[model samples]
Target: GRPPEGMWLPETAVDLETLDIMAELGIKFTILAPRQAHKVRKIGQKSWQDVSDGRIDPTTPYRLNLASGRTITLFFYDGPISRALAFEDLLERGENLVARLMSAFSEDRTWPQPVHVATDGETYGHHHSHGDMALAWSFP
Candidate 1:
């Protein structure tokens, strides 16, 4: 198995035990689909609030506590945009692909978080031919 940096689950499936495993293994964080999050409340809030359009704030880190009091962070990926990039097959051209990805986060929010776009390695060639080339060409 790879060193415990992070983990990706199939279909983003997870449960308490899985998160506990992540915490025990020293995994720093994991990505989840936006909808997977029931709701989120600030560290001290009494009630969980709905994220915009049910999408979790990707910019902030969410902490989950295990039964043993260990914690793991969850980073919700931008689900709608990710779906567009994947099923939509919008990476026909590398440069445009970058622009499209960037376009998802226009008009700064009060809180800015890292933008994460995850694609399986197989997506580069097996899923879509030339995906690798498009990714490389997008950079200046």
Candidate 2:
């Protein structure tokens, strides 16, 4: 098998030092919670717009430059949708899951967007009954 290009941090927790270490190790990307992002700016731009309030646009990945002169891509998952799937029983029905997932897309954006949902694996068989089935059905 090929080596991993990304890593998932425990509990989605992160710090700059850890990120720098990951970049040093050749890890190209990692997923994070929306609240983890303090600010963002376009690639190669200097200005960073604040997103510390957890209002980041979760549809696209952002680049984080490390102090070591290395950079890593950060992909923040949709917090509200992930919470809904975990706590609001969105996984109870496949249709509901599909609908909720679809709602994440913005029709106004011309660029491509990805809806990344980071939830516990147990959410399927352990947390919600038949959640595995619902998730599989949603993909089809």
Candidate 3:
């Protein structure tokens, strides 16, 4: 079978060497938290914009330059939204879950966007109490 888009690394697990190796292995993209993203700039821009201290726009994929001049695209997930669901009881109900997910794309996005949200595996059922039911209901 062919490989999917990319792979994910645990929190702060991917460093320069890891990315260099991944690119050598033919990986093209990955998802990281906003904090992991040091800075970003639109394509063809000369300056790097600093957004790592706060939430980054998850709508666009950003490029990272490796030491050898190779690059890999990185998608930063919605940090504030992820935090809400993880610690602030945002997933206590199906409606809350749906609302949180929808708010990310409520704007008029002209280009295709991937609203990626990352969370701990326990978020599905163990941490929030009957969370799987909420997910099932929200999607079903």
Q: Which candidate has the top score in lDDT?
A: 2
In order, candidate lDDTs are 0.77, 0.93, 0.83
Per-residue alpha-carbon lDDT of candidate 1 for residues 1-140, written as tens digits (9 for 90 to 100): 76868899887899989899888988989988777787788888899787656567765779986798999999888776676667666667886687777876747666675776666677776787887788778765
What residue runs in model 3 are displaced by over 4 Å at the alpha carbon?
106-108
What lDDT, from 0 to 1, does candidate 1 have?
Answer: 0.77
lDDT of 3 by residue, 1-140 (tens): 99766988987378888887888788999888888877788879899888869557888888888998888888888988888878877778999988988888845778778888888989878888888787788888
Worst 10 residues of 2 by lDDT: 36-45
TM-score of each: 0.82, 0.95, 0.89
Residue pairs that clash (backbone atoms under 3 angstroms), model 1: 59-113
lDDT of 2 by residue, 26-58 (tens): 899999999988888987779989999999999
Residue 51 of model 2, lDDT score: 96
Q: After TM-score superposition, what is the CA distance of residue 57 in candidate 1 from its true location, in Å?
A: 2.1
User: Which rank order by TM-score, best down to worst?
Assistant: 2, 3, 1
Residue 39 of candidate 1: its Cα lDDT? 71
Q: Please list the residue runs of candidate 2 whose C-alpha ends up more than 4 Å from where it truly belongs after superposition.
A: none
RMSD of each: 2.7, 1.1, 1.7
